[model samples]
Target: MGEATDRSGGRDRFLDRLPWLLRWAVVGSACLLIVAAGVYVLARIAALLAPLTIALAATLFLAALLDPVANWLRRHRTPPALAALATLLLLLGLLVGAIVLVWRLTADQFSDLAKQLDQGLTRTRDFLTSALPISPGQLDEWTRRAVSGLRSSAPDPVTGAATVAEAAGALLLVLVLLFFLLKDGRPMWHWVLGRTSDRSRPMATHAGGAGWRTLGAYTRGTVMIAAIDAIGIGIALVILGVPLALPLAVITFLGGFVPIIGATVAGSVAVLVGLAAKGPTTALLVAAAVIAVQQLEGNLLEPLIMKRQVRLHPVVVLVAVTAGTLLGGIAGAFVSVPITAVVYNVLRTISEDRRAGAHAPTGAPADPPSRSGPGDATGVAGS
Candidate 1:
């Protein structure tokens, strides 16, 4: 009996080690396979979707942003299709109005700019004649040569036409996609769930709901912040007597939509306008005003607005933005925040569900069924 007990204990020890050895081997192999497959899939997708990727991305963003308006309209006795159309029309009208207003206001500034450019060129020529070793004839020849070089290096007509066609196609795709997404978003979600297994439906629903809420919150909060930033900057520019103030304000507002980096670029433009139109002192004041406004938006406004809408750590946001810039340049930068929000919300929802399950009356822990042997036994025992 003692010998039999020893043999059984020895068998159990071997069984324990065997499972672990298999687990590690399986895990390592699976990880390698997954990495390889991911690379292959990503390469395939990039090749297939390179042409339409930008437009698709823009469409998705617009759909996400406009979804709340559509929902609000639905609540107010508007059908989904009509609500989407109405929202689109309202947005279009606002854009048209702003464009017209800015153009009318800035016509004088543009005329002045043309005169200023001519004066600057003359001054540059005079300065070069006085200071440089080259003769005026040589300078003129050099200028002509530079102009010829630039004209020669300009994009070919064929390439330019192709680019224009692509841009137009992209715009059309985005508008079409936005309309359908706004109209049938809920049905689309339901359809996705229907395609999945019943066992996964509840988790899918939770994840989808959480993701949509996070996206909606992010989109609405961003628009609000952008509007506030634009209004504050526009008022300041106008008060400071900045030339082309309306256009500058529109630029500032649009730049705010690009997030941290866009605002800085817009502010730089404001300062440049201040420098050109006003003077160094006014430019300095404009720069200071921009810094103050950005501080307010970043510290006070953003935190307050985004508190409940997928709260990411500053580090996470910075990292995501960096990765986004690296991957898709400006478009990546614009989409990264909402993508981070969705990912954070989904993970958070899953984690919360697990925690709640663990704390439920049932004694079993809220972990997936274990495929391991002694490790799982040890874990259960410890619990």
Candidate 2:
């Protein structure tokens, strides 16, 4: 009994010495448990929700791209639903046409492409044999092993079929979500703001508006940059008499959505095609052209467009891309930068507002409400 009393007294003394420690300890433990539970739930839902998440992301991107056009139609006396439907139909038609074109091109040239690939491999092997200290036998052995490994590592037929089905479902989901978002996005946003506390409602509105504008600007600017890249590279490949110029150009265009790595992969294919059809000299020239175009894009186009539009640092973009790829593969990489830009802008705006509020005189009148006007350009309007 005496020892139990002494221990209780000691515990009280410790608590007195660090009066807030127990309270903080309890709070921290609760937070940790909550976080752990959340993470577990997320992990469980990850695979099931992956396609849905991708669809949602695609919908957001499409919404950003088409919202302005829909709004324009609305201003011209078109009903919102009609405007959205029309936009969706037009985009769908274009997408179908593009797919048909690609399919036709591929079907017509597949045999030739196969031959070119064989010849390209042969040429590459020969060049490596002569330039490097590697023997032809060793190279052949390595190639055989790599091929065998790939075959062994590939998913089974059932798994592949399931993946295809999932992708199709996701695409359909995106289309459905995009139509609604384009038609009712503004109302939906206002509704969300309505749910916030009165003091925070303005901040939420400002943040959402700023984020939407950033996303829109990023999408538009990226499309422009990608189009320029495709046109320039396609023209270059055609002038160089490279085989599969159109296909390669289409690839570059699609790849431009993925930023640094995407362009490089597409350009490498162009160089390989050039080498396969026209030999080393032509291949070298094609490579040089690709490099030059990419450099111009990185230094001129991105700096002039994305820098002003997104205001993201290069390092931040790189890290975001890397993290996104690790988390969600190619789709993640494609959307990562734009999402980062939106989040960055939202956070910055909120931070600035908080600072302004803190610095304002206690009795001063609040700033006037922001208005939409001609000067209210998409991304820059919030600032």
Candidate 3:
């Protein structure tokens, strides 16, 4: 025991010999490396269970959006299972109604989309012929090449069928998960807390509560932002006399769910349609409108609306989206921002808790480590 103590003292003395800055730098780097390695392992596991991973992420998103309604019903004396069922049915009804409305509004416009595209291409070709050095024949060759490349890249019918089957399975899984989460989310949270270590449980509980609130805020804020974008762009299209205005508007609304790239693609589609049906002037106007709306959303709407919960810089959001896209494609992009936001909120909560604990006086009771413990009654932390 004496020798062991001496050896321990010697090791500590050696560590103390290192410069404070260097020692801290090494410690921090090691922590970061360990975190990175853990993240990599988790990512690999998620990739191996791609469908289940996506389904689970999607279920969490939906639960965040719908849990409030379920809870509200429960507060009104409805049974938990009944409240969950009602909420689910109501959501399903709304979705079906929206789909039917969109189909009825845009079916005829969709039929004319092919003709509009041809006209737009012809006009674009004519303009290029008049202004640029490229000949019509050269343009035709480029178009043929693009078309052939698309054909080559197309999946075989069996592959397409398999992909569709996977998507259907994932969708079904999401619904099942969402239902259970809504019905039993509070009880489930307690079960988790019960299993957690005594020292860690309070911290976990606080961070989790923070994360759930952040997610719910993000979900609602995003929906509002998307609706504004869709409305703004849709009105612009109608005023510009774009032929598929309604269809384009619906597309914009749907795309808005995907963030930066989604809105851009929707806008580009609108511009292409405008150029096809209404000529360059209308297309240019459509482009201007899209740019304006996106700028407004980025500059004003998001900052004001998402600021309270998300609090991420634009660069951070962009980096997260790009990394997710590179790692897991479109689904990755869809889920990345929310995951980042939740993780960030949880981390911030943990840091704040740690700081408070460190500063508190001895023998003074610490603030209830889980101040949000009572809030768990509302079932906000759904899955």
Candidate 4:
């Protein structure tokens, strides 16, 4: 009994001597581990439902972008379902029209782009041979081996066709989900809240509503930024007389969805095209223009537009995009920022609630006491 008492006493002393901050840190670490484990399990489930997950994500993105329009129509006395359907159809029509327009504008330039790329590659090889110690024969052999390797690893037609079919099916599923989400998303969210305890219901609602607004702002702002980038770069390319300017600008617009790397890649394409068709001076000018545009965007456009929507630091955005790409590829990169914003907003809401509760006064009466009590009159008389 004495030994047990001594052990218990020692343990108590050890705990007592621990710093309060250290104790909280330990608790915080455990909470972080639990959160990470939950996320891992969620990711595993998502992998199992890849197509459905993609559809759901795409639907959420579209709904975020179109919810305002639907709400406006609803306020104007349109039926909710009809409003959602109209919004979705209008978005789809615009998307299809944009695709067709880009296609028609670029179809004649495909051959030209290929020819320029081939010429560029040849010139690059010649430059390398002349500048370095490499013989033309050695460079030719390396190029031949690289081409052979690429050809060997390329997918067969059957596999490529199947992949295309899968993509089309996923796209169709996304459209269907988008329509329903825009129409019934509010009711769906309320139904989810209804399942939770009353204490948690308000927190969940606030987080969800705030997250949706953030997402909406992000989508709209990103589109505007991307358009500006494309137009700026496209106009510069045209002034410089770069070949394939239209196609490159369209690519730049699409690439904006992926954040930093997308614009870089698109701009690089413009530079290369210029190099092949318009020589070194034109290539240098195009590269300069691309850099200037990106610099302006990073410094001015994103800060102003995305400030209210996404409060993420540039480093956080880059890390999120990188991790998403590694884990989920292109689609992951595309949604990474929005997902991060939602998670951040949810955590912020929970933290704020906790802080407010902590600061609330204890032992407060539910209501003010009546002024007609005998004790109140006696106290007043004594004073």
Candidate 5:
């Protein structure tokens, strides 16, 4: 009986530890599965969406940014659907007008560029004939070879057009998705909560609210900053006499939405155009203007607008941007900051909840005040 009791005690100890072991195993397995699933999904999405992914991401961002406007309209007695439609129409109209203006500007610039190219080619041929080591004929032969090589490597028009059509289809899908998301966002949240167990509903609600707020703040702040950048840079470029300045400004504005790298790319384009049309000195000035505008946007506008939304350290943002670039290129870069913001908010919410839960009462009675057993009247009288 003694031996049996000892064995039973040992078995109970093992059983107590069994749950811990299983828990660790379960957690590890879940983590591995999650990582694998994330990788697979990312790859699939990249392959399937490609270019349209950028537009889709932009749409979600815009939706989140514009959510407040929709809510305000609803508060003012407008239906959610109508509010969403109005916001969408307003945005679309502005975008279309901007695109038309840019298109016209770009067409004119291209015509001018073609004429310049012809003159430049003629001057290059004459210079080579008169002063270069290579004969004009040799130079011409080299140019022909380069052109042939480029033509050989060019994409087939039919295949390229089909690919473009596919991308357009994907873009249409994104628009449809964005519209539904904007219209049914609240209902979807409630539905998600309703589907969860009662025990988790409160946590879900808290987390959802935190996530939405973060996304909304990021979107709104980014848009305001982008607008400021666009206007400032547009004016600067126009003053610099940059060709296609309007189109370049529009591109800069749109690019600003993608954070660090986008602005740099757009600025490079502006500089190149400035160089082509107005000379190197003008290009340098344009580049400086780009830098000045970025500095203002980064230091002043962003901090003011995003202080309440995301307070990520510069290092954290840089790291996120780097990781995003590695993971999904431009789309990754665009989404990284928002994703980081969401993560930060989630962590904060979880920490707060944990602290609250830790401090909550457990319904146990407090221990009686310490005293000598059967305490004397004076409490100290007992010895």
Candidate 6:
């Protein structure tokens, strides 16, 4: 009994020796660990449901973009189902139109892309041999070895077929999910809000609204920003007399969806094309153009267009992208940042609402009633 008492006393003192602030810090750290663990588990579950997970996330963004159009049609006396279907068809039409347009414009040029790239490589090799200490034989030997290795290790046709089939299935699923979401998104959102306690309903509604707005703004702003990048780069390529400018522009537009890595890749392609087809001077010029355009995007376009709405620090964006890529591959990297931004926004809204509620002197509304305006956009909205 004496020994047990002494050991218990020692443990008590050990805990007691921690200062109040230190105890709080330890508790906070533990809470963070709990959150991290929860996130890890959720990510694993998401990976297991990769196709469904990706389809859902993609559909939310699509819903946010097209929900307003559906709503507008409904206001004009279109049935909910009709509005949703029409909006979905419009989206499909736009996608198909863009693909067809791009194909027609670049069909002949694409045939030359391989030949042009090869020619570019030959020129690059010559330039490298002249500019560097490397011998032509050494370069040729390296290229030959790389090609031999690639040819020796052919990819499995079955694996390729399976991957393509999986992608097609996911695309079909998105279309089905998107129509339902568009048709009944507002009711779904309201139903979710109703599920919460009366005490928490206002807060839930407000936070959900903020999250939806953040997503909508992020998607729309990203599209516009990416378009600007594609235009800027395409114009530069055209000015430099670079062939495949349209293809490069399309690549840039797509890359814009991927953030930092995407921009770097798009810029690198432009520079390489310029270097191969033109010369070192044109390549240098192309590089300068890329730098200027990217800088303008980072400084001018983002702030003005996004209006400080969907902001994330560069480090946060990088880390989110890395984590996402590790978990979900390309799709993970694409959705990670937006997810982070939305989560942050919703939590912030909740925190702010809670604080306002606590500080109210008397009977006061914790959250103001939502209005239907540009300021009132969400992931889903009613007419």
- Estimate TM-scores for all models: 0.74, 0.83, 0.91, 0.85, 0.74, 0.89
Candidate no. 2 TM-score: 0.83
Q: RMSD in angstroms, all models? A: 9.9, 5.3, 2.5, 9.9, 12.8, 3.3
Q: What residue pairs clash in candidate 2, if any at all?
A: none
lDDT of each: 0.73, 0.79, 0.84, 0.77, 0.72, 0.84
Candidate 5 lDDT over residue span 29-125, tens digit each: 9999998799768857874766676776667677776666666676688776777777777777987897787787678778687665465456546
Which candidate wins on TM-score?
A: 3
Candidate 4: misplaced stretches above 4 Å?
Answer: 1-11, 16-29, 363-383
Under the 3 Å rule for N, CA and C atoms, how many clashes does model 6 have?
A: 1
Query: Tens digit of lDDT per residue, candidate 1, span 1-383?
Result: 99999999998887677878797897899999997698567645754676587777677667666766776787788877888788777767987897888788888788787665465466667766887798999999999999999999999999999989988888878777777777676666666778979756555666666676676677778888888888888888889977777788778887876667789999999887776566566778999989999999998998898757566776877787776776667766777778888888778776776666667677664543222211121111110
Please give the TM-score that candidate 3 achieves against the real structure: 0.91
> Which candidate, 1 or 2, has the higher lDDT?
2
**Stretches of candidate 5 above 4 Å error?**
1-56, 115-154, 364-383
Q: 100-150, model 4: which lDDT tens digit per residue?
A: 987887788788877777777677767778879999999999979999999
Give the true-structure RMSD of model 5: 12.8
Query: Would you list the clashing residue pairs of candidate 6?
Result: 212-379
Candidate 5 residue-wise lDDT at 189:
62
Name the TM-score of candidate 4.
0.85
| Runs with alpha carbons beyond 4 Å of true place in candidate 3 | 1-25, 368-371, 379-383
Q: In candidate 3, where is summed lDDT lowest over 10 consecutive residues?
A: 374-383
lDDT of 4: 0.77
Cα lDDT tens digits, model 6, 1-383, are: 99999999999899899898998999999999999999999999999998899999989889878877987898789988999999999999999998898788778777777877788778889999999999999999998999999987866899879989999999999999999988877777777877889988777777887888888888888889999999999999999988778888989998888878889989999898889877778899999999999999989998888747598888999999999999889888899989999999889877887787887778766545442322233346443
Better of 1 and 6 by lDDT: 6
